[model samples]
Target chain A: MQTIQTIIGYLYYAIAAVIGIVIVANFVRSRDVRKMLLYAIVLSPFVLRVLRVK
Target chain B: MADSKGNSLVIKIVVVALWLALIIPGGRQLAAHRNYEEAVVLGPGVTEVKKLSDWAPYVANTPNDCSIYVLDSGVPGGSMLVIGGTHPEEPAGVLSAVTIVENVVPTTGKIYVAVRANRSASTVTRPGDAYPQFFNINTDFGKRTFRMGDRWSNPLDSWPDPEVYVHYPSKQLLAYMDVRNLNRTWPGRPDGMITERTTRAFIDMIKAENIDIFVDNHEAELEYSVISTIVAHQAAADVAAMASMMLSAGEFNMGMEFSPTLLHGLSHREVGDHTDAYAFEIEVPEPFLDRVRGITDEALLLEGKDEFVMRAGQAGLLYEKIDENGWNIHERVGRTNSTIDMIVQMFAMFYPDKPITYESLPMRNDIVANGLGHYLLDPAQAEADRVVYE
Candidate 1:
């Protein structure tokens, strides 16, 4: 059971990492200022979570 | 073309810088709060300090494997267990238990106190509630700061909350986040979430220690109906009622209520049903938790003073009364301590054979007069071995 929970925890972090990568890619590609700002706001949490900062 | 490219580069740098500005300090603060430890000076009565995992192995490596302070008299009598920080937002409860650990010594039977019953909850403050990460109390030596925490266990410790929480055994549905609420996860399962396992560890300890009286301390918002009362299980209703009556007649206003039978996840209900112990929960008023509260900060948290809460009382919207004095930390902790004292006194009267007696604990009036800080011992002055971190 502990093993399963650990796996699930890692999976959540992996999902965050994936989302962060996607956001960064989109952020760099997007030319719209409003869209870039929105992406930055959305990406901040994922970045922190992936980094295990929060 | 050159100007357009330059503008794009500048915008990218600005966006990145903004993101860094948002997360850098916030992340650092969160990390510091998570890692900070509160100091506790073990009193003369503390014979041993055991980990919660000592009784239940399932919580051995978890964040909720909190310390259990055992104070045994060696004389044969009844045993009691008092737990605080079941809801970490309630600072008074934690401080009350700390006072017990630092000051009280049982004369007969044994006593076990958990100053931070739900340690994981104490690690994080409520998000977006603007809760102060910590609050400080002045002591004779200097000041002692304690983490001001959230009601539920940190999501970092127990994440991916279920869409709905179906309580074990009873199958009662609770709000999803309550799965991480220590109070709501009583009679917990070993294989369940971290919070559930923590409670299970406590329940195991209760059984192992042969705890005769079980007390869980808490504080509630003035608007909440359960404030300033002792909510007891039917097994402990008589003791609670007598204590409430006596305290109100003598020390302060206190009410008694029966734990609702249908309330599936509460400590007062579940712990009593599952164990031999008579379970009682004491709640004092905390204006900081009220929806009508002003400025969410340490001053409001400790002083419990707020004009907005007073206005709510004026409108008769509050279940508990408050004035300019409000319900300070000292009052809340003192009342809780007194209630615990009264409950044990009444319990002994009903069952002379299982008498749990203790001494040197400051009562409500003493605390109110001299102040709560007077009771808190300076760790710096204490012997190195006598100090423990919670």
Candidate 2:
């Protein structure tokens, strides 16, 4: 169970990083800070899971 | 566009900050649980202290490793081992062992105590039970807090229980969760799970110390038939019976029963079978442990009072007696201590050559007069070298 939980946790982080990367790229090219920033908000759970302080 | 951009960045930062708010507090709580320590003030009787790893190397650096306080008399006599925390939910056992460690002054033989027999189990509370994170005892210095732990070994230390936990040698099927129940893992295998290894380590220490008597302290729910009883291995039957009679005559209504030969993986049965020591396990009534308990809080744990439990008792569903006064922690711990004193005396009587005598530990009335906290020494007042943490 712990192993499975760890795997799922890492998966969450992976998806969050992907979303964060796409948002950063769009923000750099289109300079549409609003859209990119809203998308970046989705990355909070991923970053927190990665940190695993909880 | 500028307003939209400002809103988006503000929202993103707010979301992240919100998560950070929750994460930091939650993380601190988890860390606090893991880092919580109970201080032990060395009693006037303590002559030496040894780590569990000194006997069994497998648990050397592990969280399961614990202290073994030796109260030696210098006078030649047999040694005895008293263990607590086998089931951390039973606070009486832990408190009784601590009282013995902090108050007993051996006059004949040595008395070895392992207050946190399963140290790893002490680090976690029962998640769904809503039990308090800690319970405090009022002392002269202030309040001394102790972690309220669960019955099973912490999953952080041992996880992913088998679908069917087959007892190693007996091969009897038990609940998968029993794999982590220290009481269910006995005469433990050296290479088995962490809990097993922890018990096995104690066995090694028991043998090396040439202990004559082995005691395991515990508290049972009033609903259980085993409550208020002294369970003895076949070898220690006489001593336990005598001890039970002695206690009942003056102290409390403690019964004596022999450990069933068919029962496997228990301290009384396994410790006696696996070692030369005469094994005995004592149980006191703890109303809070009953299924019908109400308000499972620190008050319930300490006072052992629950209207629901009393109701069950009135209905003839409880094996032990219960009333409005209830069975408080002081009563439970006092009973355990007096029982231990009786067992030691009886064991000494039968085997004069290996007498283990100790003095100054409180009994029932004394504990009632001055709560469990009175016997607990203040770490602040103790010498720096005499203070240890569990």
TM-scores of chain A across the candidates, in order, are: 0.93, 0.59
Total residue pair clashes for candidate 2: 0
The clash count for each model shown is 0, 0
lDDT of 2 by residue, B1-390 (tens): 899777766765665566568667866775687678788889999999899999999888878899999999998998999999998889999999888888989998888999999888888876467778788888767888887888888766665466788876688788898888888888777777778888889889989999899999999998899989999999999999999988888878999989999988888988999999999999999887898898899999999888999999889999999999999999999999889889988988999989777789888788988998999999998999998899
Error of 2 at B91 (Å): 0.9
Cα lDDT tens digits, model 1, B226-313, are 9899999999999999999999999899999999999888999988999999999999999999987889999999999999999999
Pairs with steric clashes in candidate 1: none
lDDT of 2 at B194: 78
User: Which RMSD does model 1 reach against the true structure?
Assistant: 1.3
- List residue ranges in candidate 2 displaced over 4 A: A1-54, B1-20
**Candidate 1 lDDT (Cα, 0 to 1):** 0.91
Model 1 segments beyond 4 Å from truth? none
Model 2 residue B128 CA deviation in Å: 1.6
